[model samples]
Target: MNFILFFIVACALTFSLFREILKRGSDSILLTVWKFFSYYTTLSNFLVLIWFAALAFLPSSEIGQFAQNANVAAAITFYILTVGIANYLIFGWPKLSVYERISDLSVHAVTPVITFVYWLVFSEKEALQYSLIGYWLIFPISYALYTVVHGKWSRFYPYEFTNVQVLGLKKVALNAIALSISLVIGAASFILLGKTVGRL
Candidate 1:
């Protein structure tokens, strides 16, 4: 099933990333970027991309989300895997550069933000709420600064956002805002969960 495939890949990626983090100390800019990225995004997304590409055959209802609940459950599992990786990324590795540390920590920023927004949009049918964009907001804003920080052209770009526009700053700004707001919601949700669990 698609769920098992995704979960397994996610587990492997998490383990590999953890081993690399322990070996490398998560200090290098490259490691920081990798850790930041690895924490929040599943390697399975890549697998999903390949699965879709090989779509000479379409999946039956069993392979992927058979219902909205299944989709939510899958997303939650992915988020748990991500956070489990983050526990090590933040506290396990050697103390990192300020940039490395914060960026590495931002792995916690993506899911709840995106999920809450998905709920609002899918259920409430709203058009592009800001809470949907959280850690996602970082890919563009950070990449732009990353380009300037490294003083080179980044392969990353504004187009990754679901809403890209024609050759202007407005598109960038809009995307940034949406992602930022979503990330905030995500952070809040995580903190709330931590508190709830800790208290119980």
Candidate 2:
């Protein structure tokens, strides 16, 4: 199961990354690399890599629980990215090829579902805590700040929600606050679910 999860995530990462490089260029890849790292989806996938590695190599009752926390956090980010992208598509973004759609769905949709199920069935749920949600916000907050500062110089924002130029600083701050609140709620819900199911 760990191998399967690893394979799926590896495929998604490779597909999304190579497509970016191909469509964007070899010499100009730095911008694409920077933009890719700026995304929550990319960060979440990196967490999934850690989770997968721990599952494959770590002792079940030892380090695996620690890795489960990473998975829970990653699942939240993946679902958030999925919803955000769905909204983007609803607003009439051009349709993509089937492979592109599959790659997108693999990261944004499938990864979340699989990770959640993996947590539910295999993870030591007692390890998850509501307080960890506070830590989870740090990445998103730092990324938002970087996006705004970088946009001032590069004139590009990776996501519409963080585009300070078009939305203004106040609007961008509000969006960030709203997303932080959502992350708290989502992380809390997962923690509660883990506690409840662990008793069963």
Candidate 3:
């Protein structure tokens, strides 16, 4: 299942990225690809692909061992879930071709749900701890910082909330802090759920 999911997500991400690049009609395909990857949605789905691949093919390796950790799995689940929720709440659904829609839904909707279900059924919660949530914040915080710096250079913000040009640095910073708080809360909830499930 992990290996199969890896391919499914990889195809979805690749198709979406290719379509985006085509739509842009940029002379530099590499730059377009870099911009496409700047989106949180793309990054989160890419993380899922990497996680699934690690679990499927390299379970004995160091990275695979890290990927298999319950807290790590839960963090991935949360990040992907945020992708879907943020899309729905902030962007809603945009009109797209059928193929494009399939790619979008695969990465934003199906991937997150299935990832959570997989974690619920297979993850070991015995080692879950509140301290690990701080570690999980590293990826998101780093991404937020990267988005700000990248947007300043390119004048392109992937999401409205992170658009410093219009929203200003103060607003963007506030938005980031708000999101960080929300993630901390969500991470706690996941830990609670995992600990509860582990007991049963």
All candidates: CA RMSD (Å): 17.3, 3.4, 1.4
In order of appearance, the predictions have TM-scores of 0.30, 0.80, 0.93
Q: How close is candidate 2 to the true structure, as a TM-score?
A: 0.80
Rank candidates by TM-score, best first: 3, 2, 1
Model 2: lowest-lDDT 10 consecutive positions: 75-84
> What does candidate 3's lDDT look like per residue over 94-194, in tens digits?
99888788877877898888887888889888789998889989999999999898889888887778889999999999999999999999889888988
Poorest 10 consecutive residues of model 3 by lDDT? 18-27
Candidate 1, residue 194: lDDT: 35
Candidate 1: segments with Cα more than 4 A from true spot? 1-11, 14-144, 147-159, 162-167
What would the C-alpha RMSD of candidate 2 be, to one decimal place?
3.4
Q: What is the C-alpha lDDT of each candidate?
A: 0.41, 0.70, 0.87
- Output the number of the lDDT-best candidate: 3
Regions more than 4 Å wrong, model 3: none
Deviation from native of the Cα of residue 11 in model 1, angstroms = 7.9
Name the lDDT of candidate 3.
0.87
Candidate 1: minimum summed lDDT over ten consecutive residues — where? 121-130
| List of clashing residue pairs for candidate 3 | none
How do the residues 73-190 of candidate 2 rate in per-residue lDDT, one tens digit apiece? Answer: 4444445454445545654445888877777777676776677677668666665666666776776677678878888998878788888889888998898888888777866776
